[model samples]
Target: MLLYIHIPFCDSKCHYCSFNSYVDLFHLRESYMKALSVQLAYELKRFKATPGSIETVFIGGGTPSTVRPELYRPLFETLRPFIKTGAEISSEANPNSATSSWLEGMFALGVNRISFGVQSFNNEKLKKLGRAHNADDAAAAVLRAEQAGFKHLSLDLIYGVENDTKVLLAHDIEEAFKLPIDHLSAYALTIEEGTPFASIPDVANEKLALTEWFLKRIKKRFATYEISNFGDYRSKHNLGYWEHKDYIGLGSGAVGFLKDTRLYPTIDVQAYINDPLSIQSELLSEASIKTEKIFLGLRSIVGVDEQILSEKEQNRASLLVKEKKLIYENGRYYNNDYLLSDELALFIEQ
Candidate 1:
């Protein structure tokens, strides 16, 4: 089983961010964390997690570094017995708030990986994206994390925005390689509903050729494990999701999955604090689950198991194999190119 914890507080709201994070909820940080503990206790019992059963843990957010290490101590203590030996524990941090002290503190708590939200190394792009950190701050923060003894360091970069040139993206990749990071996630700028970018949709100008070129540049150094993810060290937490493993999601607006059911806790921070156990569940049909498996498997290194497909779908997959769009190995069908993952999944599904 896998575990995911959400921190719903941020230093500032990024204009392009539509996540369930808040800048005004600073006062409720302590109470919200306490509420997480309450829900976690309940989830542990509900999930029937055994000792050393959990393989990975990912702490994502608004920004996990915004919370102090002391605040995370109790949760780690509670998780210690359940976590397997050498489990990968990761946390997301922003360059501005992930101070040296914070990095050391989280490292001491047994977090082996740190994924920073360094959207871009270009100061102009950083400012336009409403990021709270500059290029220098991002560089320094990553260096600090390395000094803090984190072996698996990762950072994010945004691309396909308006005025994105090959030179600009090449520079971004150049600056990223200078850091001591083993993993990188390059995402295209997509305007989400209710985000500031939604009003100025033209700000997101994703050119397929540029995206392919940018990914190729990064792949020259690190291996591509997924369409957006490249790493010398692939994240076990990320792979767990693609493998459709059961996980416990702790926090408001967080989603959990167990077999065919999806669990959703309340999204309202105050309501969650009042009653963290209040959750809604969605049951996935066999067809829906199979569809997800196809999409996720195609998009990543994970290949779809042939046994899961119906006879008709298997025939469709066979056609792709004949066309050389997919490679049939052993008893699975693997995607050769992740760029066409969605289209391939749809064709098989249809």
Candidate 2:
């Protein structure tokens, strides 16, 4: 089993973000931490002795580093009793919010991994994304994290912005490589509906393709271990999700899958705080699990088992193999290259 803790508070909202995050909710930080502890306790009791080891615990969302360091003590105190030894406890931080003191506090609380959200190194591009920090701040944050004794550091970079050139993308990657980071997650910018970036007229199909090429180049430069995620070491927690392993998610807007049921908590903070047990749970059918296994399995570097693909699917895989898009070896299929195109994967699967 794995665990995920969602911290849904950001210093400022990014233009392309649609996650259940809020800005300037500092006043409610204490109450939110208490509510999270209650939810964690409730879930722990509900799944008593399920016979599994938690290999990883990822604290993601809004911007976990934006939360007050003092408020994190109780939260980590509640979790410390349950987390197994050698578990990778990671937390996400935005460049602007992760201060030196904040990193030290998190390290003291047993957070060994720090993933920074440094979307771009370009100052103008960072502004366009409405990010709170500039390129220098991103570099400084990583240095601070390293100084705080964080060995496993990861940085996120977005590629293919409008008018973003290949040279610019290369420079961004080069800057990230200079940081004392063990992992890199580079994502192609997608224009999701209802985001500020979605309404911008500059976002074009050609720009999207350019972004894709940039991502491919990045994968080549920094060993792509998974689609959208590349690093020296793969994220064990995220791998659990791709492999369809069980996990417990705690906090508002969290989702957990356990014992054939999928539970999604209310997105509203107040609603979750008032009724911690008020979760929308559904019993997942076998077919649902099977479909998800195939979909998610293909997304990872570790490809699906040979038995999972039908004869027709095998033939499609063969076509991809011929096209040099996929390769079959050692009774498994892998993308011919490191980069896994979602559209191409869907086409091959269908």
Candidate 3:
């Protein structure tokens, strides 16, 4: 089992972010933490025994690093009884908010991994994205995390930005290589409807092609283990999700998938604080689970099981194998390259 905790507080919202988070809610911190404890306790009671062996714990958020380190003490304490020994505890930190003391405190609290959101090293791009940290801050933050004794560190980068040229992309990759990190997650920028970036002019299809080209180049430089995520040490918690393993999510705006049920909590912070047990749960149909398995399996280096495909699909696979677009060996099929091609997956479906 894997556990996820959502901390919904940020110093400021990024222009392209649509995650459920609030800015300047320091006053509500204590109350929110208390509510989180209550929610976890309630979930524990509801899911009896809970297997007792949690493989990973990922604390993601609006900005977990922005919260006071002392506030996290109770969180670790509450989770102690449930976490298995040697569990990988990870926390997401924004570059600007991650201080030396804060990083040390998190490590002392059983967090073994730290993922920093260092979107880009370009000052102009950082400004356009509304990120609080500059390139120097991002580099310093990683060094600080390492000095604080965090052995496992990961960094995030965004590609496919309207202004991202090949030269800029190369520079970002070069800057990332300078840091001592075990993991890297690079994603194509998508403009969600509610995000501030949505109002900006959309990049043309040709620009998107360039984005893909840049991503391919990066993938060659850094091994691509999964779609959008690349690392020397891949994220076990996220891998669990891609592989269809069960995970429990806690806090406001948290979503969990336990066996067949897809459970979600109230999105409103106040509503969640008022009634901790009000969860919206839905039992997914069998077909939905199977479809999910296919979709997710295709996204990773581990392709779908041969048995899942029909005879026609198998024939198509043979054609792909001949064309050198895919390879089948040791009872598994894989894309010829690590970077996934959506077109290939779509063609296989047809």
Candidate number with greatest TM-score? 1
Query: Which of candidates 2 and 3 reaches a greater TM-score?
Result: 3
* Candidate achieving the largest lDDT: 1
Q: Give the alpha-carbon lDDT of every model.
A: 0.95, 0.81, 0.83
Question: lDDT per residue, candidate 3, 113-146, as tens digits?
Answer: 9999998999998998889999999999999999
lDDT of 2 by residue, 189-285 (tens): 7787788888993652336567667777666656776777877777888788987877788888989988789989888987877876788999989
* C-alpha lDDT of residue 241 in model 3: 87
Report the C-alpha displacement of residue 349, candidate 2, in angstroms: 4.6
Candidate 2 lowest-lDDT run of ten? 336-345
- Model 1, span 203-294: residue lDDT tens: 99999999889999999999999888999999999999999999999999999999899999999999999999999999999999999999
> Could you estimate the TM-score for every candidate?
0.99, 0.91, 0.92
By lDDT, the better pick of 1 and 3 is 1
